[model samples]
Target: MMTSLFDQFASPTMLGIPLIVIAVMLPWTMFPSPTPQWVTNRVITIQMWLANRFTNQLMTPLSLGGHKWALLLTSLMLYLITINMLGLLPYTFTPTTQLSMNMGFAFPLWLATLIIGMRDQPTMSLGHLLPEGTPVPLIPALIVIETISLFIRPLALGVRLTANLTAGHLLIQLLATAVYVLLPLMPTVALLTAAVFFLLTLLEIAVALIQAYVFVLLLSLYLQENI
Candidate 1:
């Protein structure tokens, strides 16, 4: 089996570690960007110039309440999807599969929710977590429950994405390993197993994209709720 170094760890960590590395490496990719440094710098300068030119010309621009947020989220989705799918390469790691990477995204999401919610409904937003309709006697319990729930949203998001990607990658790795392990003992069965693993890799690509979209969609939904 042609396995990457990332596959050496326990199943959970196999995807987790690479995912974290990928997230940390994201910003650095811009420095010596996949493109030539000079090219990248020129592109950046041109983009800035164009953006400034547009800003000066625009007037009475119709904007959504969350237009900035939407653009930010779209950038996030593009970056995450690109990085996650990059793991499909022969020896690359997928950072989206790591706890740290997922949590990095989740933390911002959690904070954004709170900030936007409070901004949108200053007096009612934070307070409405418990809702006025709740019985006065249960307000304390409700508040506690809502607080816990709000905090857990990011945790759930992190765990869900990390676990899904990690499990999928591990499953493919194990299946591939099994093919090699059994090849000498039973050539026919081993070949069939290897074929299965090849199919599994195809499915994993789809899973990777779905996971990225799900994470972005959930984040958007959270912002929508708050906004």
Candidate 2:
């Protein structure tokens, strides 16, 4: 029974081909491509509006060098949002919930920011390890601590996304199971549970959107520091 609860998280396969690959690629098909018309349809207009707004907001805090990432970050934000929201549908697998996949998304991007810092401004980047005006004795220990924290960023990014989505999914499943089991035995309790489940579903939807945004937002912050 315990094992059954987590079965949904197992990667689905067909004749040894992983369905995760399909899931990751599916979101791209949902967006409508723009036409050559001078004025576009409402869907394309809204897409343009949202993309412009997000790009403007994200680029606000960034330096001119960092502005180059605006397009990549905006597209990533949309992709994540679509993927996360789609997972909330019945019988769908969320790719972001897997640690390995989330790490794949996080590590390379995190490393890119690190590389930019090291290559462009090695002194300034290393200086981030030690605070200004530190005591002679504390410098070594602080540098070591900062170094550990630096390396841990990607791990933290992956774990945060995976943990939040996993926990929410598990709770929703438990509540669903409770509703199903209690329906005949205790109609009133089951009704209440179903109501709670409905509310939780809404919250989970919000969480899906927020988590995607937070993931991208953190990447931007990392880029800000480096650039």
- Runs in model 1 deviating more than 4 A are 1-63
- In model 2, the Cα lDDT at residue 213 comes to 88
- Per-residue alpha-carbon lDDT of model 2 for 43-78, expressed as tens digits? 999999999998999999999999999989998899
Clash pairs, model 2 backbone: none
> Which run of 10 residues does model 2 get worst, by summed lDDT?
1-10
* Stretches of candidate 2 exceeding 4 Å from the true structure: 1-3
TM-score for each model: 0.71, 0.97
lDDT (tens digit, per residue) of candidate 1 on 1-227:
68574553322345445344444466436433235454457667775564455333221132366556654665566566677677677655676776876899988877887798798766766775778689899988899999898889899889988888888878887898799899999999999998899899989888877777788777766766666
Best by TM-score: 2
* Reference-based lDDT, residue 29, model 1: 66
